[model samples]
Target: MASRMDRAQAVVAIGELFREHGYHGTSYGQITAATGLGKGSLYNHFPNGKEDMTRAVLAHVHGWFEDNVFGVLASKTDPMEAVDQMFVQVDDYFRSGRRLCLLGAFSLYDVRTAFDAEIVSYFSRWVETLAGCLKRGGLSAKESKVQAMACMVDIQGGLLMAHAFDDAAIFTSSLARSAKTLRAAMGDRVPA
Candidate 1:
């Protein structure tokens, strides 16, 4: 088995490339090159090759969201502060929208079938967690769910727009609007 650091580094490198080129677009050679590891070393880490590497990358990405984004949303704290932290984590994950999302890219292709269950669970978990936060902030359960769905849509669409327009501000503004919506739901306002 590879060292823990080696595995972590490999997963991160794979995620970096996959977030841009996507699963099918990313080649084994590219993965090795990104990790500065030889083909044999990569194969040793991922004996099943690219698919195994992608699975590890997906888990790594999911774990990051679970810890950073979902954890903030689930925290019992000032709602707005939690909302801000969630967006901050989102921004960091996408490199302020300069990068594509690994899962988002996968969604555009038929290849998602291979990892459908895991991918769906990631998104569902995010929506449910955010809905819980919205509920705590005074939205009715139904309303909170609706808002959570909208937020997810906004995030996915906003990231696409940001990448296409080459403007990180597009995503930043979307997050601001989503946050404003949430704050308004809580009967609060961002001071002018």
Candidate 2:
């Protein structure tokens, strides 16, 4: 008799595969092979099939992101420094060891409807959080939201470009330029 796999293990395994190969690239067979589970075992855990498994992966990644990135931002008292630190953490994560942004990859996947709402909600929360940090740094509500969204887009776009080109330097350069632009926009508003 095959031992039943835990839900947490399955979620982590699926997320790792998705992170490496992306949505369209990864297959159920690959997942099964990674998890060392049979077809029936996979279905037993995720009755809704790949959609359910993807959702689980998203949720798992979201939690990990919040812990690593968002948590760092929220912990800092200085908003400007916090925002800068956020980007630093992002760069570090991507360059740490061939680590690509899972959310960014998932967003570009062709199966748009599969996890749209969840992905949107997660990103919306991230933007709002960043906007709040900007507001703390003296930007007005509208300005804060705009700056936050721009930063988010810059990071995601830079990462995609870097991944596509197989060049980490491109990502780092884009982030540096974005940081400079952001600081210049803040100008006298930024603390010494």
Candidate 3:
């Protein structure tokens, strides 16, 4: 008999599968194969099955993003630098040859009903964190929130365009344009 797997390892494996194949596109069998766990063993950890596993994956991704991306972005005092670094972080993230965004991929899947609340709450917190950063950079609360939403849309769209075109340049250019626009909006108040 195989040794039992830990919850963290299972969650990480599920996240990798979800990242590669999306929620609906991935199967329980595939997850088991990927994790080297039997069905019963899988269920032992996630009794609710795929939905439960997916929820765990979403939470895992959320926490990872919060700590790595948002945490780093929020650390800098210069709002403009923070915004620029955000793009740099995103560029490095996608340039690492990972074509799919875990959250973006999950949103595309039919398993929407399975993780709706978790996904919504995750995105809401992301937006609020970004908007808060922009507000600190001298933008009005309303402006920051709207701009943050626009930035998120641009990122999603840019990723799609980059993948469709089979080019990273498009993604880089899109981010650069966004940074320029944001800097222009901030005017003299933008960090030196």
Candidate 4:
């Protein structure tokens, strides 16, 4: 048994564990080791065990994206600049393909059914926010949504390919192509 840590620290430790090993693959022993906390302390912090811990972790991730990613996309001043900022934020957040996407990883596994609502809301909110920005940029509702979904697909799919290839350039190229396509869709002059 080790000393107990603060709840926030424990949540972050547990999140990294979960990110490395999917929900089913992660175990109490690993979490305890990662947090340097005993089983009893973990129980005290997360009464329902991993479920409660995961919910807390998800909430934390969601809050971060809401503030950093979604907030900019929702900004009213300049939607195109917001879209451009999104690429920068996403690249920085993912560490240029050196990091795994926790939400995307979960969605690939069976546990996706367990956390359906959280996962769905995460993707949905991003797409809707981006679509709204495109709409304000003069795109019709249908086309904006189509392009928004395409952009997400490129990002997530690029992540998969980059992870498989062990190459950050793949992800960077994917983002560049997607951004170019978006500019074309918006009838803006695509910078060479």
Which is better, 2 or 3, measured by lDDT?
2
| Candidate no. 3 TM-score | 0.84
Q: What TM-scores do the predictions have? A: 0.91, 0.84, 0.84, 0.92
Q: What digit string (tens of lDDT, one per residue) describes model 1 on residues 1-192?
A: 223348789899788888778777888777766787778878788999888888898898899899999888998466667777888888887877787877877877877898887789889999998988878777788998999999998888889999999999998888889877877876742222
- Pairs that collide, model 1: none
Please report, in order, the local distance difference test score of every candidate based on alpha carbons: 0.82, 0.78, 0.76, 0.85
CA lDDT of 8 in candidate 2? Answer: 87
Q: After superposition, how far is residue 146 of candidate 4 from its true place, in Å?
A: 0.4
Give the per-residue lDDT digits (tens) of candidate 4, residues 5-110: 6999888878888888878899999989888888898899999999999888888888888998888888855667778889888989888877778888889998
Per-residue lDDT of candidate 2, residues 1-192 (tens digit): 224457788788788788888887889788887887787878888998888888888888788668877776666787768778877777787772256777777777787677788788778878888877777677888998898889888888888787788887878888888787667666677555
Give the better candidate number (3 or 4) by TM-score: 4
Candidate number with the higher TM-score (1 or 2):
1
**Candidate that scores best on lDDT:** 4
Error of 4 at 78 (Å): 0.9
Say which candidate scores most in TM-score.
4
Task: Provide C-alpha RMSD values for all models, in order.
Answer: 3.7, 3.1, 2.8, 2.9
**Backbone clash numbers for all candidates listed:** 0, 0, 0, 0
lDDT of 3 at 11: 93
| lDDT per residue as tens, model 3, 1-192 | 324468888898888787777777888888878787898989988999887888888888788778766876677788777777777777776663335567776666777666678778777877787887788878889998898888877777777777778776777777777777777767775545
Clashes of 3: 0
lDDT: worst 10-residue window of model 1? 183-192
